[model samples]
Target: MTEAIASEAASNPGMQMKYKIVFLGDQSVGKTSIILRFTSDSFDVKYQATIGIDFLTKTVYVDDKMVRLQLWDTAGQERFRSLIPSYINDSQVGVVCYDITSRQSFENVKSWVEQARQ
Candidate 1:
């Protein structure tokens, strides 16, 4: 999908490219918060668990060229865990998020990293 969209942006193929970045971690670990802050420059106090997968895109100039970042906000719920690998396989980057205050969240980072590595 990333390649397909980037290819479709044929107006300036050489001047522009796209990348997919997947966020992974345990529940309430700030994956969505980080994405929200980066994309919208705002944070929500109302906590909500991402169901399935949520996608957001942002474009920026890099080295005098256009770069479109396709951010994949994946649900941290166990039920959604099965759906992450396909996204990981297609992504160019993976971000493993964890809550600093929660030992379990921090401990789970290794597993999240392992999944991203796979």
Candidate 2:
């Protein structure tokens, strides 16, 4: 169903968006957790990793105009970087996350930022 909808969206030139966003980071760096917080104001302590990518949508008021967010959450691992290009291609804003207390996670933010920029 997702693939079909994505295909339909790809073929439709009239489907323009007022806003879109993307989140990128390394594995175990809490990208999904952060997104869950933003979308629902809640977090899960369980550690099941995001397999590839996930998406969420929310509507918000922007200066009295209604706008919707097409939030893309990309998988955070070396092997998953290849899947990120398409996800971030049309995003208007990018968010890069890293665990606050983890040194390696913090360092890896640079690589994630670079990859997201590409």
The lDDT of model 2 is 0.75
Regions of candidate 1 where Cα sits further than 4 Å from its true position: 1-13
Regions more than 4 Å wrong, model 2: 1-17
Predicted candidate 2, C-alpha RMSD: 7.9
lDDT of 1 by residue, 80-117 (tens): 99999999998988989999999999999999999998
- Cα lDDT tens digits, model 2, 25-118, are 7788888887788888889999878888898887654333445677788888778778888888887788888888789888988887887677
lDDT of 2 at 83: 85
TM-score of each model, in listed order: 0.87, 0.79
Reference-based lDDT, each prediction: 0.87, 0.75
Q: Which candidate is the best by lDDT?
A: 1
| Distance from true location, Cα of 52 in model 2, Å | 0.6
TM-score, prediction 2: 0.79
